[model samples]
Target: MTKESMMLPARTYSVSIDRDWRALYEEIWQPEYFTKWASGLAESDLRADGDGWLADGPEGPIRIRFTPHNDYGVMDHFVDADTGSEVHIPLRVVQNGDGAEVMLTLYRQPGMSDEKFAADAKWINGDLKALKALFTPQRGRNG
Candidate 1:
């Protein structure tokens, strides 16, 4: 048996949504939404290769394809270009009475670094915050 040289660290982050979290996620989590929310976005849908999806930001391009789960959730299978490994990012929705909660979890390979973990955390935190701000109605704001 051979030891793995490089491995990605596991990371997870979540936030509450103003609307139905599952529905909003299913509707909004896409390349278009990333371009709208994420900085320095570059994305495309390559149809020649079975509708492969690509999105790039400050953390480099994350090539992935999405699949909807039966339990009102979704999964992003990240294609590791370097090591040919796959990383799974799972998202779920939790009902919170009038609104909902969005949970995002990132599962990385073993031996991921502190720097990478921190970066991923910061990005997800900020992204969720921004998303909530955009969807949530502010006090005294017009309908």
Candidate 2:
């Protein structure tokens, strides 16, 4: 593929969180917070590696680079698979009335089987739900 090429067969998944977008983004930036809700994205612990992160993916060890912290609530990340292929994962937290909407875009990579893509989509949906649950309030015993 040429440089700056865009992948096709993309899907965008989103979840609604009952919290301020900025605050949610800040909480997500905290160390270990991501792993709590993104277990499907990284199967093993993620360790700091200079400006990027290293994780033991299901296939093998992989490197990830995240977008720098900013005021715009962007948390885009790129993953480099052990097979020498790189995939861009677009993520964002945006305001939705009094709540926040988190969106993640998944691109169907070249040679990716349909079954694998469907599984990834389901995993992404579950991960997003887990993220929303973090900001959801729990019911007390009285309830």
Candidate 3:
């Protein structure tokens, strides 16, 4: 790899959720749930439009196109940041033991600072935690 490529390696993060891969995929991989758990859309409103969805991004209104759910658990998407730039996010859910692991692979774009990358990683971690908590069973009142 070139020195420049080495400096901007793809970052991957995964979280193990105590749920079936299919179940989790069905529950979380939807346009309605983007704002619910996705860090990038935390403050965005995603709504279905003609072919894709319209979303409010950090810059401004953005267009989002998501890959259809498949048996292989590939849930990738593209977000148009309104600057003639489109970012492709690769995500997957792989079966792991009794549960499943949700993995997100993020590519470090050119000119991205180390601090910004760290912050993005932290944000992804928080989103994964929130996803896990959403599926975790609640304790009983008397217990």
Candidate 4:
């Protein structure tokens, strides 16, 4: 098996949004918004006695569980291609002047290759660019 197929790796990405932390966190970190960011990124309804749930991501079904982070003013959770592990993800939102910064840190499965790592980083950067555009004001003629 390839390195990526055997272990989890840790990765971090940050985004600066032109909005308050609380409002930005609430508005952008929802099931609907996730879906809009990428096709099929919606939360699934959980039935009683359910062990796990899925997020319909564009790539495929991404397994997830909703976790709360009170002080950060946002709900967070773990998401992966599998759900039968002890893996849990923690996300945070920080206030940065009138704008907000969001940091996403994920512990990817170990044994992941350098190429895979590079690809993941590139994907995250692209995603953040899209996210910033979504929240930032468009350039208008001022001068």
Best by lDDT: 2
C-alpha RMSD values across all candidates = 4.6, 2.6, 2.6, 5.4
42-133: candidate 1 lDDT, tens digit per residue: 24322213554655434555555556344555544355443466566666566777677777776554676777677777877876687677
Best-to-worst order by TM-score is 2, 3, 4, 1
- What are the runs in model 1 whose C-alpha is more than 4 Å off? 1-11, 29-31, 38-49, 69-71, 79-82, 138-143
Please report how far candidate 2 places residue 107 from its true position, in Å.
Answer: 0.3
Question: Whole-model lDDT for model 4 versus the true structure?
Answer: 0.63
**lDDT of all predictions:** 0.60, 0.85, 0.83, 0.63
Stronger candidate by lDDT (1 vs 3): 3
Model 4 lDDT per residue over 1-143, tens place? 99856655677788888788988887866544554443235234422224445655555556766654355655466666554554465566789898798776666556667886787677666766777778766887982
Per-model clash counts, in order, read: 0, 0, 0, 12
| lDDT over C-alpha atoms for residue 17 of model 2 | 92
- Predicted structure with the largest TM-score when compared to the true one: 2
Residue pairs with backbone overlap in model 1 = none
Every model's TM-score:
0.67, 0.88, 0.86, 0.69
Question: CA lDDT of 119 in candidate 2?
Answer: 95
Q: Cα miss at 98, model 2 (Å)?
A: 0.9
List runs of model 2 lying over 4 Å from the truth: 1-6, 41-43, 140-142
What's the ranking of the predictions by lDDT, best on top?
2, 3, 4, 1
Clashing pairs in 3: none
Our model 4 lands, by Cα RMSD against the true structure, at 5.4
